[model samples]
Target chain A: MASTRSGTARRQYGVAALFTAPFFLLFGVFTLAPIGYGGWLSLHREQTDGLGLGGEPQQVFVGLDNFAQALTNTRFLGGFLTVGVYCAVYIPVMVAVAMVLALLLDSAYARAKRFFQLALYLPNIVPGLIAAMIWLYLYTPGLSPVVDLLDSVGVPFSLGSDAGAVGAVANLAIWEHTGYNVIIFFAALQAIPREVIEAATVDGAGGVRVAWSVKAPMIRGAVVIAVLFTVIGAMQLFTEPFILMDAATTINDSWTPSMYIYTLTRSYNLGGAAAASLILTVVLAAASFVVTRFSRKGATP
Target chain B: MSDVSTLTRPAAEAAPPAVTAPERRDRRGVPPLLSKGIVNGILLAATLWTVLPLTWLVISATKNYADLYQTGGFELARIRLWDNLVHLFTFGDGLYLEWLRNSLLYAGVGAAVSALISVMAGYAFDKFRFPGKERWFGLVLVGVLVPSAVTTVPLYLMASDLGMTNSFWGVFLPGLASPFGVYLGRVFSAAYVPDELLEATRVDGAGELRSFAQVAFPLLRPAFATLFLFGFTGGWNSFFLPLLMLSDHHLYPVSLGIFTWKESLAADSEIFYPLVMTGALVAIVPLVIAFFSLQRYWKAGLTAGAVK
Candidate 1:
């Protein structure tokens, strides 16, 4: 009986391993191994012989030189700063809009909640590239009725200018993301016990007061997660600006850190690109850690 | 606060019955009218804000190029949507169809295979007690936090090394490794799949694989559908990876294909603009249908991800 039991235990382990093998295999190859390779690549540089293109390029260890160069690169630094401005505008607006929309949907006074929820989430269903494309036409002068209407009304609404271009991209991000976060916030709102809300309403709290004091506090965890994800997303802004690059002159080859990395990779500056990627990764990791830790503290008591 | 509660107690009890008639008129099934107008008005504005661009896309796609530029923003000058669709499908040897096909293949096949892998891993993690399980699961949690965008550059480098760049496999293979899907699978499996059933199958002399295939797999249908939709949308919507990996236009997904057309509009706006708008419309149809039909699953998935 002991031997039979041991055999059964071993067989279970074998079966478990078989079931899990594909995930770990793909994860190691596509996720883990590339990350390790990127780290190694960051520490090395490609050196060429005389005339800089004559012979086989030699891979030479560069220690921290590539990282230093990446940090000082004006375009990379500018992209980082650009995203900083973007986050400042985007995070607060998105969180606030999502929270407001979710609250309104969750409220008793709001009619046609299902229709509103689906309508609001419609943009999110559109692919990011397609969303960018749709907005690209919307922001264009001759093609956009918006531009024509604004021109007729004499509002001078043009995304051709530098600040206007940034605002246009921010608007695209806001439109694409608000619905997704709204759904999350709405879900979180639903999770709040009905009795707590009833108790608040019975205590004579008005709509605004109940939403602000009761509903908002209760879904703080979802709010924090939304804010953190938005921050991380803002740091990775690429496709919107990339698709809009031709529409606006303000958007250059390197409009964000990811764009800068893309430009570097396109130019075959692998070491510098890898170094920059690592730096961005570190920043992202640190920000996520801080947000999670901060939210955890807030959640406890 | 106590004084306020006491003062409002009588009013609160009296308000519900008083508000019932108006509540019956209200579709939201709530007993409040003071804020109804304000709330509905705001919601209408928000809905318009969300929908106007899409509505514009549909309307604009129906207009001829001349009418699109000449007419007012909201006016339907002429109905040319069918003509635009024809031109879109037949343009450049039907490259748009090819792109649509590529997207469907990439998203469809990638999602199916990925869902299977995730479900299997999740089931294993949930049903079996194994050494180092917690440690392995922790790695997956870390994977969830490590944004896939940061890894794309390295993935590109690795793909180039393998000479898989510009191939369908390049995009398809990396998409299969979704840590979030695995996490979801585990969560769903734990909630849905009963271990007692597996044990009963085992006692019935069923092999492990057979028990899983016969007993557990059927039970995981909802999870499979949820994961499939998640992965499908993810793969369909993916842009940066395919952009980085694929240089060939023929291999481009709809997102990248439409983007290329949009880029061409910069040089010559008139020719490609309508084509792109129409193509954009076509690309989003499947997703919109999926959104409307599978809303409950999406809601369940979102709340599941959030609460965890």
Candidate 2:
């Protein structure tokens, strides 16, 4: 009986392993290995002897020198600062826009909520690269009716300038992401117990009042997660600026942290890139931790 | 068995409940606080904001080079949309078609395979108990937080080391391991696949794998659809990894292809502009169709993730 039960237990474990093995295998090879490799790469730099053309460059252990350099590099620092400004403008606008749309959809006064949801989410279906391309044309003078309209209104608009460029990119990000967050917020709103909402309604809470006082607080966790994702996403801004490089002169090869990493990698400064990546990851992780902790505290209270 | 029948009886009865709540609410005759006109106006404005760019894209695609440059951006000129489409497909030895094909293969196959892996793993995590299961899952949860961008450089390096850069597998392989998908899969499996059903199948002499395949998978079809849509869109929208892995234009997906065209527009604006605009429109059509047709699944996926 003991032997038979052990056989069954072993078979169960084997079946579980069989089912799970593929994910773990791919996860290790692609995810875990790169993380470990990146950490290792961050600590080393390529050493060259003579003209460095006669032989392969030697990778020497540098002991955080790359990290130190990445920290001080103005371009890298500037990229972080650029994204910082972007986050400042973007996070609040996106959150507010998404929340308002979600609240409106959840409201009794609204009609065709499904249509509005689909319409708003259309841009998100367009890849970030494609959206950026579309917006680039819109921001361009010759190709864009937007430019023509602005010109006719006697308002000069140019994505060529730094502020204009930032705003343009931010607008693209907002347009692409707001719908997604709206869906999230809308879902969270839908999950709120109907009795609670009815109670608020019975108490003569206005549509806006109920949305603010009841729905918002009820969906605070989703809101926090949305903000967290938006913040992380802002830090990893690549596709928009990468595509907009042709349209916006203000955006260079290293206009954001991910861009900086890409530039470094392309230039064969893999060590520096790795260090920068680790630093960026650490900062983001810290930010996420703080946000999670803060949100949890707020939730418990 | 008695408990199962008892639990299902109430659900079976409740499933056919009438739409009386809305009717009763209407009878209550409480006036809405917010004006319908104001709500509609706000919604209309938001919709316009969302739709206008795409409408511009459609219009721009229809315009020829001269019309594109000469006319007001929104004006529809002589329909050269066909001409643009022909040019886009025929351009540079039909590179756009190749890109489209590559994208379809990558996103379609990648999403399907990834979803399968995710579902299987998620099912295991849900239905099975083993040593280190929680620890393994915790690692996956941590993997969720590790931004894919942060891993790109390292992945590139690792791929290059293995001489996998510029190869399809480099991009295809990494796209398969979606930690979020696994997380979602687990959530879905737990929600959709009841333990008792699995036990019943097991008692009927079905093996664990057999029970999962025949009994649980059918029930998890909705979840699978949701996961597939999520993975498909993710793969379709992926740009950076492909950009990093692929240098050859032949391997370029539509996103990269359109980007390259946009880059060339600086040197030769007149020729590349219409082609790029047209290509962007064509490239987005598939995704737009998928989203519109499979919107419910997409919404379900998002809500599932959000709730978690």
Give lDDT per model, in order.
0.83, 0.84
Name the weakest run of 10 consecutive residues (lDDT summed) in model 1 chain A. Answer: A194-203
Worst 10 residues of 2 chain A by lDDT: A1-10
How do the predictions measure up, each by TM-score?
0.91, 0.93
Off by over 4 Å in 2: A1-6, A148-155, B1-34
- Native interface contact recovery, model 2: 0.66
Please tell me the interface RMSD, in Å, for model 1.
6.9
Predicted candidate 1 versus true structure: per-residue lDDT over B15-71, tens digit per residue: 223222322221223555658888888889999989999998888888777787798
Clash pairs detected, candidate 2: none
